[model samples]
Target chain A: MRDEAALMRSARFRAEREQDWIKLEALVAKAERGGVQSLQFAEARDLASFYRQATTSLAIAREISLDKALLEYLEALAARAYLIVYAPQERLGGLIGRFFAASGPQAMRRSALFVAAGFLCMALGGLTGFLLYLESNDWYYVFMPSGLAAGRGPDASTEFLRSVIYDDSPAATGLGAFAAYLFSHNTRIAIFVFGLGVFACLPAILLTFYNGLIFGAFYALHVERGLGWDLGGWLSVHGVTELSAICIACGAGVQLGSAVLFPGQNTRKEALRLAGRDAVKLAIIAALMLFVAALLEGFARQLIQDAGARYLIGWGVGALWLAWFLLGGRSRR
Target chain B: MSLSRTRPTPNRQHRRNRRAARKKAASRVIPPEGVPLELPVASLGVRVAAQLTDLLITFAAAVSILILLSMLFFMYWSTVFALGALLFFFIRVPYYILSELVWNGQTLGKKLMKIKVVAHDGGSLTTHSLVLRNMMKEAEVFLPGTLLLTLDQTAPWAVWASLAWVAMAFAIPLSNPHRMRLGDMLAGTHVIRLPVPILLKDLAIEAPRAISANGQRFTFLPHQLDHYGGFELQTLEKLLRAQENRMSQSSAEQNRQAMTAIVERIRQKIGYADAVEPDDELVFLQAFYSAQRAHLEQRQLFGDRRANKFYADARPRGTG
Candidate 1:
């Protein structure tokens, strides 16, 4: 009860300063609504000074008086001012340029081991399937899912194989659905290869291998019918980007999966977070690659009949990808 | 596997935070390291709610699109169906990736929940981070959902694998201080609740004395003041404010009861002497306020605004 003089002093202080606070609050509201651009030079200066005064008032109000209303008003005002004044923004254009020109390639390079592991799985699986299918034709069915055959299983005759490959009619009905299905399937598989990499890349590696095995069985079946080069031309157009994208997706997954499994000196969560920065970049790039592959398969594959031109375009695209991965973003002195 | 214990309270979990803070303090140097700041992570419940909201929204969008497509291609039911499936799968791609991009890390659900995604390093959200996290969503969440819906009969192992993956998604966040799922972990992003702090309004009081009329303020030595830190100071400040308001209240007896409880707690906390009179609550509070304010202001000048007692004791040692 004897603290009455202190309470009077605090209330008196608030009465003296209340007008300035109301005026400043109005100014801050204007600034927030229209951005700092709405304020004149003098008004902006006044706002800054008011903010400083408000923060100081907050500190004083906290220690010297128990005026809870005044304290809260000042605290809220100060916090709002802090957020508005110190709002952080990064330049989108500059960051985008920097990321693609430097960070993306750097991340891909860092994930080389994962890419190699991915490629190794696919190549070994492909080799196994090629030999197994060459030994006997039933291995094709064993390698490929029966549901996924799309009428290319072992029962299909040599005539059917050659005719489908050469069928370049402009009027292709039901082909849109087929194209959509293929795109959906390929995208699903690519994403699948990347996603399952979280299991320390086991499932991803096996999937890449299984994909390659199916490809190998298909290749062997075509070769036995003396249409190996024709089929190569047919596939090569998009295979350049499609296959490499699969490798990239697998690599990105391995980057994440192994980071969790190993984690190096950091904790598992920390390691995964760091590796994720790289993995996401690679996965997106791989998705982009798949899109390009789909575009090529849809538009260009039907138009090109000569095996030589297909080989030229396909290998050329592959070389371009190699150059991109190796030399896209190296800074020059 | 039951995560009921780890759920977030509006106030950070007292028990977990206290233990972690203590461990952090015990391991830290006297000066502390990395600022030893405390930021609350969003709870699993809030995150799950946000996710479900997003799913409901996407489902509605897919359904609307399917209806339109079906009507447009009324003759081609199969095409309509396939396109619907494709849209269902992909509608989220633009919805999530673009919303987070344009809004700088808030999807509609996250925005509604007042939660936002921020970089793990406490930086601004980048396009790459958004893309990466959303892309990983294929594996982290959607794949499991898809497997559950389809349940491929030929691939029995796939069901178990999807279930395990989903289980890991729930399990992983429990292990870290930040409740980060796989996507969050990979994207190096975490969600934070943007709290607009609600201030507690103390009741009105008639003018009270600046200094007690009897000159009966409890005196304390510098060492006695040092016994309590900023955390206790803030608490005491709250107690004094409440008591100030209570002075004019109808329930004088209840006010006295509450004031005595607070005074007793403070006595035990700071090891104040047992010599203080029972009727001298106001005097003790007045004396402590002056002493603690002086202590804090002095520390502030030395650039040590110890926000709480935890800041005082958290000493960093070498770590793994």
Candidate 2:
């Protein structure tokens, strides 16, 4: 009687254990059927524990004449459960990382080019305005005020030039400094635009060319006048660095666009991310160049009066800008 | 116990039973794997990238239009080109709208990049969304707005005054959880990475590639099912129902052994001579069944042994 009772009890125990496993399997199937939510942290952890216990129970049940369907079912359940619970988040992380890696550098480079172009365009616009002023009937008055133009009144030109060079007011001095920062910031924006080309390269191109148009229009206004020589001397002092920054920004933008537009072996996102990574430093460098240009514009170009001295300052600044950009400290290209 | 009563009295019916269980499991799992493809999730990076790209592309278009207009004015053709620019305004917006609406939100440029614009729920983009996204182009002026001041002699400091406001307006996207710009939110559209196909046999135990904890149970429908006849399909399905019932009655260990035996029986009946050597019962069962289905399908259809092996080998274990 005891032997029969024990056998029955063991059978019942096995059946009960199987039933619990089945429940666990059903939960997993439900989760898999539902989506990734079926494998949340808590449920996945619970499933993991269930799998361990089930494995041991399964080993014990192996000695008896268990159903084959039950084993197959358990095996499938355990596999799915373990994958959801114990697998590291490497794939997701890797995917995101690759995406950034591919786009980041390219973005930075494009931004640098945009900044350069923006500065060049704007400076050229200023030159254009100067030329237009020269064409006016009171051309000399515009340059040095009425007194200086008359050549017999108080030398207010000296005072005005001095204030422009040395005054601490935001417009006279701070504007130059801010312009330097803007040059760099704009470059960075351009880089961001280009590096995100997987989304489309339109933004970078639009930004780069928009600045170009403004510069063209502004310069056209100046060229319409007769002060082209004076305008050239005034702008070249800062235009070199500013314009280079814009070009660098454009390059960065192109990098981003190409990354997305041509994601060779990588996904579009991955390519863009990689390009963005490379473009960041380029943007910083472009900003720094713009800052240097701002200092020259603030102190040297506006204040200087002797045409010869102005020409010399402009040449020196242009040389330095070219040397640094074309063959700089790092020579990244 | 009920499944046991329903089990075929003949041992030859065991292979048929296992096959049926596999089919039922497969039908449940196939959709999940491809779900990521059909319902793509737009990540923060993608959204940001999309916004930036849109900004650049629009800026380029604006610059081009301005240049074209300027050239027309310079050439004494202001009326013709100014009208052309105005025409572009009408044409450009609709071009983008039509492309996105008809081609799953893929603009020519986006299509080239293999990225597409989609709604938040991963559905098709709407016309309203297209208009909203494009209208945001007005905010994309690249010139430092100094020109606005330079042109507006009445408001000389307007450029400087509005600079801060412009900067602040552009900065809103930085705060968004999804890195969305105003246009993105208003349009209810986002950019997402497209799906790349994954091979079935490749989803094995590499530890790093593991999916859900209950990996074994996540069976998908194998492609081989297209070949089964109505009566054979019915027979296989009935056997699977019997297996599901029998599984409830047995201990886990006893269950594994029985499954292994059943797979072996199926291999023999299906005339899969090499499948008899059972290294891992589940693996053998999957490979053998897939191979048998392929072989049978080919014999009935193509009668080409070599061609059939290629399709059979391509069949993944327990996938839809």
Q: Supply DockQ values for each candidate.
A: 0.15, 0.03
Name the lDDT value of residue A17 in candidate 2.
Answer: 72
lDDT of 2: 0.46
Q: Which lDDT tens digits does candidate 1 get at residues A207-314? A: 888888998898888988899998898888888788888888988878878987898999977888788887888887898788778777766777777789988888
How big is the positional error of residue A320 in model 2, measured in Å on the Cα after superposition?
2.5
- Alpha-carbon shift of residue B244 in model 2 (angstroms): 38
List TM-score per model, in order.
0.71, 0.31
Q: Write model 2 residue lDDT over A1-333, tens digit each, in one string.
A: 122212332234455676567666765665545533556687766676676766555444433312233334444554344333322222334533543343333444335554454445445544554454445534333333222123411233444433333334444333434333343334444433433322455655555554554444333433444343555555566665666666665555566566668879986545654554444345445545665765766566656655567768777776865554444334355
